[model samples]
Target: MSAVTFVSNPIHEGWTLTHTGGDAPSVVERATVPAQVPGSVPLDLDRAGLLADGPREDGTAADWMAWCEWRYATEFAATPATPGERVDVVFDGLDTVAAVRLNDIEIARTKNMHRSYRFDVRELVQGGANTLTVDFVSALAYARGIDADARHGDVSRAYRGVRKMAWGFGPFGGPPAHTAGIWGGVRIERWRVARLDEVRPLVTLDGDSGRVQVHVRVERASGEPLTVYATVAGAEASAQIPPGEVTGVVTVEAPHVEAWWPHGHGPARLYDLVVDLHSTDERLDTHVRRIGFRSAVLTGAVNVADAGVESPETPQVSPRTEQVSVTVNGRPLDLRVERWMPLDTVLARIAAEDVRARVEEQRDAGVGVLHVDGVGVYESPAFYETCDELGMFVVQDPPFVGDGYRAGAPVQGEAIEETREHVARLAPHPSLLTYGTVEDRAYGSLVSGIIAVLDHDRLTT
Candidate 1:
């Protein structure tokens, strides 16, 4: 990577190019710390990084691609005056869609507007000032054209699929035809991560024995043989994890286990789990997770044909498909009532605090399961982590609304990749249960393929 410079204009410093702008005007500030790198340069409302723009006349899909490239190039900052530390570039909204690149290296991307994307930039960034750019693009023309087509309205999936576009929404209205720019924040930060990259410590009861299944994933760059150890509810176990992507399973049986209860009953007792990754005898990373020992399973489908709504003929599936709930410690609890609201509003205004508060509120209300409708945006990693912490179960579905039902080779590939990413992010969470089927459409073998990506070890319906 070449040396990057912060400038008012889109200037070239060595091999790095820098530019910045936002939904509003801002000042030209120096990139004094890592957190200010993304939106470090001052930006305007021009359609530079936008994939497509317009008053709607001659905009094409090609325009959208160009706009996406530009949005990826734009710069953003977490704070103008950032402390020197482990910086995290967090993307609340990249408009309808975008991929974030740091110093010419691709870091993250999101197709749904309702999700928050974050990238760890500690390694990519160095001491002193650095150049950060945000390339935001628009989805106006594609969104509008898809909405207006006669054929687009023919199927249930068509209307449902458009929900993920996340362009036409909010107080400021939708993206302009062909207009694409960074509509969200480019924040850099002094962030924190537990020593482990991935930690999965599960507690379960089988027959008369209580077990804790432990799995840990260390950071690849650590470049050291890790000593994996865990202490759950005061019980400890240790194992040696040699270097190069280690995957080891250690099971601990608790002879006297106290079960976790459902909402409105007894309080859920969370056991303290300490996972440490060590090099030789020195600890390289340590993560602490409050884990609760619980067992849950979806009982049955309620109102599969028609939710509460009544119709004349045999009503097939509507929005309310399953009566989803979880059973904990022999008690059944109805999950939270939620609809798949499009990612438009939330994605338009990306804020970590806002996302955290929303999830916390849901948990406080005793909501354990969130049935996410496919007609809206996908949840972000930050959102999922909050769910994991709050013990919220997520039922995920790939975008499959309208005539655009993805199947066969192309869609299956996409779904497999999506499953890999989703499972990698949320598999450790005890709250996460089922990986739902596609909405309103089904591809015979595709279901098996998707399950194989993540839950291959278990048998399912």
Candidate 2:
């Protein structure tokens, strides 16, 4: 345990919804409501009987999809803290595009729904009340503009599904609509000196001894003395944490350790791993993770490119698909595959229980591997937690797939940034065994490349 204090407040209230009135609007009539994130305004209004069943026919919410914005405002009170402590406003998900301001000053701009965002707001935190507001824009507008003015032979499909409003979506599961809003809770966390930015633990066992490889990233006071410890099975390893940025691989050797196994293999035993960080003056941060010692090895491969340099009379054969499989603890799994569509078009409204129940439904069907499709935004936390607890393998396909890049297309700098955030956020999960991209060659390369650099433990497909 450590002394770091975090103050969290979910921004579930104090919000206003308005539409840029036009022909074919989802918010047919203007209305205001609390920011019941993870849900859309229409969904909330319908629940409250404020709006009639949304647009009974096609393209009814044209303006709604292409326009419409949600605004949230609240006054924040800074906590009693020491001089060196830092404060941050965190967002787990922002539907498509957002501009956030604190005390009337813009602080962050977010575009990817798959990424978690945070703004170091120490400079903006005031001794008195601080006003923070977030304005969300309809990305569909930008997408529509691009679609109309698209140059010939653009990369693959050029646009992504999540980028614009499409043919299928509404009360019924037709085409998909944007679930605009803060699709996740808005909260605040404050810390001092050192903060445990990230902790990724990989465990393996040999005979009765266990070997732990913990990747720890920390932010501490520059040039200050810091120490870190990894403890398990009554054994521990402590070392000096390098000043400024202390992020490195810390290996711990444990005796009489237990190994975790997947379903039907054996008991899925787990141990509580506690990594504590301390400065010269006081305890700074503690990160606790549920870890199991096991080996996940991906086997089999296929040739991605045809290197057949044949003469006029010669012929060649190319293997363009993957004949891949996985093994755990040296035991090959005859995997039962399970595929899920976008859990919800309105992602934030999805209840934790709902996601868990869905995963359980498949796990009960003996799903050894859950193919997290690369079609939509990343699945929710509940979805991943259930899979982790049940030992279900995740083939994480970052939310991207369409036509591949084309000849003379614009550089996909934004798409690359989105891929960066999605990969970094999902990298710590032990259940994520592979980084699988959709078949679009150009887009897939950009997406897979980020995963290649950021993740070494997981296999790339």
Candidate 3:
């Protein structure tokens, strides 16, 4: 048994709930205390922790619910037989907005509640006397506007019926559980370091010959030159790269190199491409990435009816007729789709346990693409990394939509900067396929102009 603890607050729907199996209700009932503790501040005073004018503690006030604030810390033993070299601290989520301080150093934050968030603090901490502090601010009360109650009575009833019709449970089915708290799994993990910051293996086929480009980026801290090696289809090649830049191009002549096909016809022969970056006699990092020597382009026209698989009854509509789809080389593929809403302030107030379950469910469903919509704010990088390895494509839009009165003028430069920050953080993923223009027509033009000026390698319009 290791010396760590599990602490969480999960609010499902309007109810405060716990995720610890059959013991959750009992645990919450025993943990409620009104007295404030030292170093733990109340998010709101005067009202005595009540949020949105909910029911009072005595249950006399109508619609009473505790303001989503809790100053609590608990510990759990570390799991035995861990997999990595160092322990990594991961926070699955903390509502819509959270400030996480590990041993007094602020480490993470989240703006969207729709996705689970995480942080790996292996380098930030060491053994003995580790302190973790997380402040989760709720967005639930505001999210009430988007909840079903805001709709017409009959429509809301129909929505509930549809949910029961489909999944046997409506959206509003509970007491407020842990709304704004550490709601997901928090753990210390271990993993080995990669020699290179990034490794991209590019394979291109033309008639009879295949071209391979081993593009790599090694960190300056890893002070060493690397001999990069690759093995594919019983063919082998090596190239020497200096410490700073490790870009190399190699050619292979394989008349029978099997090509991959999309969704139909012959099998998608995925050849194993292993890249090893070695320093003199020592192996530094071994990175593996799938390289499809094929071409994929948008096929359909940009029209509403052609939009891929969106629910027809949704209030939102895609303006373009051509819903985005990919065809590898000449074959069309029917890829699964997953949509992402921004982790807004309202969502941050919700429980992280609910968020984690949703993420796992989507992953379990074999969602192939994640369309991060523009309405919500940017999500944590954990979501992106999951999509990258899970074989999911990501279509990211700048987190701005609608035409406010202040359009053409420079209104919120910070918002644009925030969007740019999100793009920079997640753009390196191989799964990221497209960048949607901001909602405003003029803003789209501005974003395109900015990308053209900054990133000249790819075409963006």
Q: Which of the numbered candidates is closest to the native, going by highest lDDT?
A: 2
lDDT of 2: 0.60
lDDT of 2 by residue, 147-250 (tens): 43233422123244234222222313454454466667777777777677767666666765778777777765355767778887677887777666578667
What lDDT score goes with residue 346 in model 3? 30
Q: All models: lDDT?
A: 0.47, 0.60, 0.44
**Model 2 alpha-carbon miss at residue 253, Å:** 2.2
Can you write out model 1's per-residue Cα lDDT over 1-461, one digit (the tens) per residue? 12111111221222222223223212111112122212211122222332223222222222223222233333333233234334556654444445566767777655444334557777776445555554443333333344444245322222222223322321123332232334445455442212354565656755434677776665444445657777776677887766565566666666665655443455555567776665664555566666666666655444545554333332222356544545555666655444434333323334567777876676686666565555444566666666555566666554444344433443444445544445555554555555555533544346546556545432133
Measured with C-alpha atoms, the lDDT of residue 385 in candidate 2 is 64
- Alpha-carbon RMSD, each predicted model: 9.9, 5.9, 11.9
RMSD (Cα, Å) of candidate 3? 11.9
Residues 1-461 of candidate 3: C-alpha lDDT, one tens digit per residue: 12112222321222122221112223232343332111111221212443334433322222212234343343333333234334446554444345667667888755443334445665666445556655544333323323344233322122111101100011234222223444344555433322454554545556435555655555433445667777766677888776556455444444567554432234444556676766666565565544444344433323455444443321122334224446555656545555676332233333445545555576577654466665544555566545444445566665545432133222234334444444434434445556655555546666666555333222235
Q: Which ten residues in a row have the lowest lDDT in candidate 3?
A: 160-169
Off by over 4 Å in 1: 1-127, 139-197, 207-210, 222-224, 243-245, 304-318, 322-327, 331-344, 348-369, 378-394, 398-417, 440-461
